[model samples]
Structures are given as C-alpha cells and as structure tokens.
Target chain A: MVCELCAVAKKEVESELLYEDNEIMAVVHLKPAIPGQIIVFPKHHYPIFEQVPDKIIAKMFKIANKLGIALFESLNCHGTNLLINNGVAAGQTMAHFSLNLIPRKEKDGLKLQWEPKKASEEELQTAFLMINEKSKELHPDLFGREEKNEELVEERGRPKEIKLDKKKENYLLKSLKRLP
Target chain B: MPEEEYSEEERKAFEEKIKRMSPEELKEFQKRNCVFCQIIIGQIPAKKVYEDDHCLAVLEINPAAPGHILLLPKEHHAIMPQIPEEEIGHLFMAAKHLSHALLRGLKCGGINLFVANGAVAGQKFQHFVIHLIPRKESDGIKLELPQREIPEDILSKINEVVQNRFNELMGIKKELVKVETKEHAEKKKEAADEEESEKKKEETEKTDPQEEENEDEKSEESEEEKDGSISLDDIASVLNGGR
Candidate 1:
C-alpha cells in the first residue's frame, strides 16, 4: 500500500523543515517554481484539499500565511502563489493536502497555461455544478475504517502504526458515546 | 443575569410561535450568522445530497474539484471553538455517512476532508463547516515535503501527538454526527418542504405578468439601442456635425 506521496511523507523530513507543529508541517518544495517555493501541509494526511477539516485546514493556512509573509519579506520577489491542485486532471501529482506558496516575479514565467473552453452554455452550467455536487459527495471519511489497506494505497497511505494511546481512545469513546 | 421571566401567557405564546415558525424560522434561529447556514435554510439554495438532524452536506458554491461538498452543522457556531462537544460528534458522523454516499453513490475517484478553524486560516464561512473535496489524480494536489530524511523520532512524536488529538476530535465528531443524524430525518424533511416553497416562488415569478413586462421593456430597449436607437453616440455625432 505504498502511495508515492505517503512513502515520501513517511520516508523522512528533509531540508524543507521550515516549521513543524503537531497538527501542521511546512517544507520547501522539491521542484520549486519560484525561488522560495515552499508548501505547507497538514500532517493528518487528508487525501484531497477540500476534505480536510475546517479547523485543521485553517491551521494549515495560518501556517501558510505566515510562510507567505516570510516569503514576501525575506525572499522579496514580487508576489506568492498559494496554489493547491485538487485532483489528477487538475494537475495533482501528490496525494496529501498541500498549499504551494511559490514566490513570483513579473517576468519569471510560470503560467497555468489555461485554455478556457465553452461547454455549450447549459451543459457548461451543468458541468460547473457537477464538480461541486460530486465533490461534496466524496468526503475525507471516504476511507472510514480506522485503518484499511486499500485506503493506505488510496489515501494518506496507511497511517503508520504509531502506538495508540489508551487514554485518548477512552476519551474518544466516551465522547462519541454521548453523541446524541 | 437572571433568565428573562416569561408569564404563563408569554410562555404559551412562545410555544405557539415555535409551532408556527415553519422549519425555515427554526433554521434561521439555529444559524446565528453563517451564510452556509443560510444556504441550508432555503434563504439560499444549494445542491444537497446527504442530510440528517445534526448536519447537512452540500456542494460548495465555489468548488475546487468535481466533488467538493460543504459539511455544515445544522446549528451554527462561528467556528469549532464555539461548538459544543455534542455538536462536534454530530457533524463528523453526518460527514462520514455523506462521504460514503459520495464514494458509492457518486463513484468519486477519491475524497478529502477540509475544515477552517479561524479567520487567518482561510475560513470563508463565518459559521463553522468542513469541506469534503473529491479528487482525481490530475487535480495536482499534493503536500510539498522536504526531499531529505526527517528524524524518525521527530516523525514519531509528530504522529503520536497529532493522532491523540485527532482521534479525540474525530471520535467526538463521529458520535455526534451518527447520533443526531438518525434522530432528525423527519425534521430535515420539514426543512426540505420549505424548498418546495422556493420552487413555487420561482414558478410564480416566472409566470408573473409584471416580471414579463419588465423583461419585455428590457428587450425592447436593447433592441432599439441595437437598431440605431437614440444614444449619447448619436448626440455626440450631431454635436460634432453642428460644430
């Protein structure tokens, strides 16, 4: 169940270790588009960008913002690209959620190379809506079981078998029991 | 401050009002200020699929991918910091089921969960909600990481601490979502009924004579303008010629 991204995520932390919190992590990009092209990610390993919880996602963005400020002041190019590629067709090469904060300059040329197409107004509207409606369906809970081998192949890669804490589990169980 | 006192009649009136409220009113009251809450309440409409007592899952108006759904707490708080423990469980549980529905129902290629806790964190919704974004390999979403090795101890520690917190949070969310969703499908149906009102409103407006008159006038005005109708350009030409 070795996803390339997860293998890399699990392999080891490298030079991009700008910041690391329990819930969040930041690193410099491997193939940076701009000079200080840093990308920040949540350690939780949410498979897609949208499915990450609001709280965790917020924290990740806060870290991203801090990095954005850093890149703006220290690196001093022009602006930064806080890019996130959601799916394969959208240009996603990795499985984990990340915000690519690539520093930008006016002339340095990094274009998305977008070619907008017409979808036959009505059909285009339907397609426009289809993206949101369908994505709404595929939630991070897609791989629900605490651990699944296939999910490991699919999502954040099998969460490494870090030791479980009884106290935490108990706390979760008790809280969940009171859900109603 | 002491609880505001209500006389018997007042209390009775309040009960009556509650009864009269129509789920729309309750939902308005339920959400303090979240636009997403407004979307759920039919003040605005969203493409919704999965719903339960505790929460509703809807497609994001602005989507990052093909299957991006916004998971909202039916009852609104500004953010997770404001949500009660019971609510936390309720939300995630609904999210879990909705996610499954997405995978099997929609046949999504993959799924992701997202949430924003605060303003600095890109939380566009004032009312707390999580986003469930579906994925395709071509979407180009990945976590940028260091190319070199991170110490095992550091990684282990990060995993240990985060998992404990995540399990706690996720566990609570699962419970709440499961418990509340099952209990309130009937209430949710009542809410759905309000959308019928929205559709009826649309139908009436579509058929309304005044609306038709306005459309006719607008069309006539545009046609005349297109057909060399009076305009500043004509006046400017007239002025130039006179000069």
Candidate 2:
C-alpha cells in the first residue's frame, strides 16, 4: 500500500523534483548515469504501464516530451535517450514505474549496445502473421470497463481504512489538494 | 477529385494480388506494409494488451521476457526523430500502463523500456517502436554499459564535436562560431580556413535564386556528417577507437 513513488507523489518522501503536474512528476535520479538523467512517473501508484488509464499515460508522455526537450536544450547534451525498465528482467531496479531520460554525448562512455539476433525472412513473416492473427481477437473496445472493473473489485478487498502517521497524513492531504 | 472506378473483375484481381504479395511487396505499392502498422489498422492480428485511438500496445511475438510489449502510435513512423511531435509522448504513456499490466498481470519484478532508433541500435524493424522488456530476478537478459577510460584531451575533443552536432540539430546557430573555434584550436590552427568556408553558407543563401533547394542538399550532407544523427555508429566507432 505504501509505495516509494506514492510517497514521493504524496510528498511523504523528498526527491530532486524537476516538474510536477496533477497527473505526473519529473524528478532527478538519485544515482544519475549522466548529469541530467531524469525519471518521470505518474503521480498515482501504477507499478506497471498497463494498469494506468490511456489518458494518464498520455499525460505522462506529454511531460516526458517536455522534459526531454528541456533536457537537450538546457543541458547541451548531444542527444537524449528515453528508456523505461518495465519488468524485473529488463534491468528494472525499482518496482515503481518510471521513465529514464538520459543525456547522451559522444564518448560519454554510456553504452546501450546489444548484438541483435538475426531473423530469417520466413521467421519474421511467421512471427508477423501470428501476432497479426492474434491482434484481431484482442480487446476491441479500447479503454473498456473490463480491466477497470476488475481493479475496483481488487480495491474493495483491501482494508477500508489506511492508518497513516499524523504528520504524513497532513502532508499527503496537502499534496493531494495541491494537485489540479 | 472523384474516386477512380474499378471494374469488378479488376478489383477482384487486385484483391488477389494483395493476398499473394509479401508485406515488403505491399510496401512497394505504397500500402501499409509494416507489421505494426497493419496491427494498428486491425488488418493484422495481435494479442494487444492496450489500445486507444492515438496509440496501441501489443504483446511482442518473441518476447525477451513474459509480458514483453511493443508500444506504438496508430500512425506509422520509421524512427523516433521522424515521429510526429504530438504522437511521440503518447506512445510512452501507453507503455507505462503496459508496464503496470505486466507487473500485476504476470507479477514481474521490474521492467525495462528500450527504443532502438536505427539499425545500429539493434533496430531490426523499420517501424518505430518502444520495446517494453520485462525484468525478473536472474532472467539473464543483460543491458550492458561497458565503460572505457580515455585520455582527457581526446575526451574534450569528442565532447566538443558532440556538442557542436547537438547545437546544430537544436538550431542554435550563434554558438557555431565559438564551437568551431574550440574544435579547431585543439586539432590545429585551421580555425580561420574553416570559418571562411562556413561563411560561404550564408553568402550562398543570399545570392542563389534556388536557395531553398541548396539548403535541402546541404542539410542532407550535414545529416550524413552529423555524428549520431542518422546512426549512432559514429559515436560507437569513436569510443572503440579511444579504447
């Protein structure tokens, strides 16, 4: 229930804040790979990408684009690298979802190179057809109540009252009000 | 303009041609050929995790891990830089939701989001996509960041070059003179010679009736020369050279 990112969004935890809006926040990473490496995330506790609503995702990316442009312009870096570590296998350290906006310069010693496995034309076509066929049977009604309704049931199972520390509660309430 | 009328037989033949053609062949006819584009239009099927009018997220066929997803806009874009400004942010927003889905749906520990722009960045497919690679403990899929030590002088020179390129991309022309001088001072005192050549750019624009056409060619040339603009191979080569 008490997530680090939730705490940060609620102002329970102090972070190097860059930009914050009602839907999302951009903060400096504690251990930066580059000078201006930033982490942008949604204000609410959405651990992974799929749980958040489309509108919320759009807002987060809007912030990311702004942060990216600002990062390049203000920092004077050669280019920028925007990355997100989704699940644990992808080198995701934190459980909370966040996008890493890394400032890249020539010979900055920041390397994200990988040897690609070659796929034959046939193999590629096979994969393409499989994915294509499966896509047709997917959730046709975009942003339907199906997933959200399930989440509501999950929420109802949890304890109704959350006993927050008095100081933290006040801070969290203030932060909540501060949000548009 | 009125829509062209096709005879029923001709239309039937065209449909048959479409069925016979590979995706690449479809591209030659200026049809939607990219697999991801086809998915967007619902022509090709996908095990879609998320979809909205502006964007869509689908399960990757050869996933690096369980719940690995590919997020993209409904519109097709070959590379990140070429993506429309408005659609750029929405794709990642969708990815955020997909990441949450993987965490809860598959119960993965963490996640990694990767965007491979050109071929050098391991971008096999031409269509721009953000790969949502799920991370779990001991999954063994590595994202390596190998560091190398280089001499300070060379490092500074590299920095200057990269900075100049970035400045040019950002359209900060005022700093061009200062950047060129810094670059030339280190390599040699060839600063005056380059400056004279650089002055020709502005002069040509003023004198030429086909200035717009000339500018287009110059940009294309500069694009090839610009390190990490078209491909990151230039930067990679420099780093490798230093080692």
Candidate 3:
C-alpha cells in the first residue's frame, strides 16, 4: 500500500498545502485535533523518526517552528503544541513520520497533561547514569566531528548522497510493509 | 492609605515599571523570575541527565514516566516563536538524542517528544522546554489528541491565513529565490550557519550582564523552598500501578 503521507507529499491527494520546498511539506490537517492544526513531514519516505537523517529532522523542526508561529498569529490562539509520536506504543497511528502543530487556547479542554509519576531515588539515579552514558556515546557526531567532515566534503564538491546498503534498505522496506 | 489599597498601588507601580522597561531589561526581569533559569545557572539543584553548550536535559521531579526528561535551552526564550531557527534546530537535535537515550535507558516501548508553547497549551512555566516522555504499554498517561471534523470552509480559511502569515514571516521572495540548484542551496545553508554563529556570539555577550543581574537577585532573595520532592512511597505506588 502506498503511504498516506507519501501521497500528501507528492500532492496526489487533495490536501490544504500550507508550505512546500525541496525537502519538506506542510499541510493543514483534515481531521485536526484542534482547529488550525498543521502537519509537517519530509518528502522522503522515513517510516520512523530514527530512520530520518539528522539534517532533515532539524529542517523539519525549524519549519514546524515557523508554522507554529504562523498558527499563533493566524488563529489568535494562546499557544501551540509541537508533538511527535515516534512509535506505535506512543500513539503513532501512521507509519510515515510527521510532526503535529496543534493550536491551543486557554481551557481548551485538550487532555494532554498527565499526572506526574514519582520514581524512586535509585531508579532516578540509574536512569540518570544510563541516559548520560548513552547520550555521550550517541552524540559525539553531533558535537561536531562528523558534521565538520560532511561540511568539508560539501565545500570541496557536490554534497554526497547517502546510499543505504542493500541489506539495510531491504530491512527498512520490510519494516515499512509490516507497519499498518 | 489602607493596607490593601497600598499593596494594590505597589502592584500597579510594578506593572508600570515592567511596561516601561526595554526589551533587554524585560528579558533580564523574566530571567530573574524563571525557575528553570535558576536550575540552568546552578542556583537550583536538579537531577541533570544531559548537558551541552546549547541545552540541558534534566529528569523531571514529577515525571510522567520513570525517565521523563525536560530539555531546556540555556538561553531564555519564553516561547517557540522567540527562539531563533538555528537554536530550535539545535534543541530538537539534542532532544532526538535524549529521546533515544530515554528509550535505551528505561527500556520503554516508545517516546513522545512534546513541547507546549504557551500557557493555554499547559505550559506551567515561563521558560521554553521540550518534554521527552518515555512510553511503556499501559503507562496510564493519556495524551490523547482526539480529532474533530472541522468544516471545510473553516479549514480553507485557516489554510489561507496561516500560509500567508508563514510566507510573510519567512520572507516570501527569499523563499522563491531559494528554489535553485543544489550548489546554491548548499552555499545559502553555509551562509546561514555563519550568521547563526555570529548571533550566538552576540547572545552570549548579551547574557553576561543578565548573569550579573541574576547574581544580585540571588543575594536579595533567599531561595524559596519548592515542594514535589520525590519519596520512596510515591515511587512504589507508581511502580505498582502507575506504569
């Protein structure tokens, strides 16, 4: 089955397209959670947030921020919510990753808030150590080593397109097909 | 004057003072009042999970889940609109990593990255923050965003208004110009990066005076104690049924 958001990105389906550029698209949500809610997604088919490249994620968020400000101005709402449900358990209905910019007002009766749960001191400490170590391990590239290399490569010539290996590509396609 | 009348007069004078202040002064005043800024500057102790130059991630004292984290930018931005695009990008990138860490650390099923831009959106604090809530099956957190069928005409009207406003904010002509070759896009991105770095330098310089002001306020006000302290009983109850 064709991804619904892919259709939206390609403009195959009728959508209230708000903004479009080379890499991203923003359109007004049809069945909105709130009035003036907009959905922003990348042109490429990334089934999950982790699959999307860092640069595209950044670009999507920056665009979402702009659209968020637009919602505030146009709808005259009190605020906006930038929400991303990354997996099935997190209430991600669609396989295609998208960001929701929900316009909100005072006492709008949106039930997004949760009662804060308390974790034990040991649990909190373990979490802190585990996350700190994992973050340090995963975020070295973001701290400017590989990013500089990519920039240098781009400066030298045309930016290199990242090609996934055949196995990884197959895995991604399989996962996409597996998801509803 | 009566005591109530005297206090009301004082409150009015304070509001007038705030209104008369410059933008920089207003920012400093807000910074002095923000609790998160105090947490960032080491005035208030927090259980920090991650910290970089651009942002800090701390475990929520009252977490929605076991490892829920609140990622905050070091600078004072009251809302999403006030933040620069580059800073927004950086913050989200950091958030992505933090979410990943939450998943791996807590062994949760998923993650929800949530940001409330203003008071009506359930933003209790004045500081801009991104909430990374770790999700497990039957976690009992209901962040259900139920869809409503809006009228077609209303959607169209909203579309036009928001699209026009967005284009205006983004500079429509500049966006049109940006539709060009890959080389041109790369060049433009590099130029934007340089400009962002320059802006960061200017912001750091601007924050120095605010830091001094914060120090003065710190001396004047004894840190007011805040509740919501974690306890083992609360955690035991959460572990038993909440999650």
- Which model scores highest in DockQ? 3
Shift in Å, residue B72, candidate 3: 0.9
Q: Which docking category, incorrect, acceptable, medium or high, applies to candidate 3?
A: acceptable
Error of 1 at A153 (Å): 35
Better of 1 and 2 by lDDT: 2
Interface RMSD of each: 16.5, 8.0, 9.4
lDDT: which candidate is best?
3
- Please, what are the lDDT tens digits per residue for candidate 1 over residues A100-127? 7654454554443222233344533554
Model 2, runs deviating above 4 Å: A1-16, A45-53, A76-78, A87-90, A113-140, A143-180, B1-67, B78-93, B96-110, B116-126, B143-243
Kindly report which residue pairs in candidate 3 clash with one another. none
Using all chains and alpha carbons, the TM-scores for the candidates as numbered come to: 0.36, 0.48, 0.73
Alpha-carbon runs more than 4 Å astray in model 1: A1-13, A128-180, B1-243
Question: In candidate 3, what are the lDDT values of residues B1-243, reduced to their tens digit?
Answer: 123444888899998999999999998888887889989999889998866666878998888876889999999988888888877877777677677667655656678999998877888778899999988668887765687776665666577667878999888843322122345445655665665567668796776666566456543432211111233233223212311
Docking class of 1: incorrect
For model 1, how does the per-residue alpha-carbon lDDT over B1-243 read when each residue is reduced to its tens digit?
136999999999989988888878865665734566677678876666555555667665556654556777777666554565555644544554455444434444544555544333345656777666555545554422223333333333222232333334334332112222334444545554565566568786554565456457655654553443333343223212321
Evaluated on the second chain alone, the candidates' TM-scores are 0.47, 0.60, 0.65
